[model samples]
Target: ALQHYHKPSIFNSDQGAQFTANAFTGTLKQAEVKISMDGRGRCYDNIFIERLWRSIKYELIYLKAFDDGNHLSQEVSTWFRWYNRQRPHQSLNNRTPDEIYYESCL
Candidate 1:
């Protein structure tokens, strides 16, 4: 989806090991996508993703303790659904990410 809907021009991510790995970079390059990486140790350069991680951990991960990978996956999926639908975000003008994104498209 995102290509079918938003069709973003660029994709950006932090210079983490995962993003730097050949597997990840190769896939993006194959898609003819331009990749932008944050400078090392520059937290502010990736503030949006950092804030998203903080919300995910604090609102979901920190509150739950799972027994196994399956359990964690289920709970995380549920939490992500709720986060995108129900949770209001300050940066989004009190709207959930889904709401803001779809509304902008309209």
Candidate 2:
């Protein structure tokens, strides 16, 4: 990740001493990247990931019980493919993510 992407202007994370440690903050400081933190005990810090977990629980994970870790992994992979390539999101103007992404690439 460090090699492939340009340094971001700001990084957001929940409060953790490890993140606040000099080693970590020093790197961001050297890079001139701003660090943003969530308020303690606030639930909104991980809203997007939380929303995705909600969707997976309601739409896929709760539908059937998996016999093993491999089965669960496979099903999650399939669900992601269906999510990105097939399902239309109303917020995206009823287009699948792949459609919007690939259109821009071409």
Candidate 3:
């Protein structure tokens, strides 16, 4: 992710073992990224991501039958591209996420 996209100022995640692991946190620290972990039992802290997952599941996953992990990953990647670059969100005033994100970057 650091190679393909600009490094984020902050990385947020649940208190999962994979995220808390030294190797993972160390990499983020090396990149000068701040880490934010949600409080235990505080699912609302990540509501936006949770909504995204719900959208992915309803719009893509539930509709498709994947042959394997590779296929699933590929399709999901395509869906994400569409989601970010093409799909407009009412919450974002009908602008695609890419539009809002790049606009904010400027």
Candidate 4:
């Protein structure tokens, strides 16, 4: 994910082989991003993102049938744009994620 987007201050993921692979970790280290791994038996460490995934699957993926990868990618990107810029999150006090993020920068 970081390979294509803005560098994050910290990257958190489960201790899956892909995440722990040298190539991935080396890229993060070179970028000076902190690495965080979810501990064993602590499932809720990534609950928020997991919840977002659930929302995406149920609300978008499950509801659409794409003809190709490009189609799926475009639709997913559109969904994410709406999710960040329009959809209000209850946990964020009914504000969109984009709103909260830009507000924090100020």
Best by lDDT: 3
Count clashes in each candidate, considering only residues at least 3 apart in sequence or on different chains. 0, 0, 0, 0
Q: What is the TM-score of each candidate against the true structure?
A: 0.85, 0.61, 0.93, 0.88
Best by TM-score, which number?
3
Estimate the TM-score for candidate 2: 0.61
- For model 3, where is the 10-residue window of minimal lDDT? 40-49
Lowest summed lDDT over 10 consecutive residues: which window, candidate 2?
1-10
Better of 1 and 2 by TM-score: 1
**lDDT at 106, model 2:** 82
Candidate RMSDs in order: 2.2, 4.3, 1.1, 2.0
Candidate 2 — which residues are off by over 4 angstroms?
A: 1-41
Model 1 TM-score is 0.85
- Identify the runs in model 4 with alpha carbons over 4 angstroms from their true place: 1-6, 40-42
Cα shift from native, residue 51, model 2 (Å): 1.9
Which lDDT tens digits does candidate 4 get at residues 5-64?
Answer: 778999999888999999999999999999999996676998987899999999899999
Off by over 4 Å in 3: none
Tell me model 4's lDDT, rounded to 2 decimals.
0.92
Candidate 1 structure quality by residue, lDDT tens digits, 15-97: 88998999888877777778998899898999988988998899889998899999999998998899899998887789898
Q: In what order do the candidates fall by TM-score, top score first?
A: 3, 4, 1, 2
Candidate 2 residue-wise lDDT, 13-105, digit = tens: 767798789899888888899998788877588686567779889999999999999999999999999999999988789999899988986
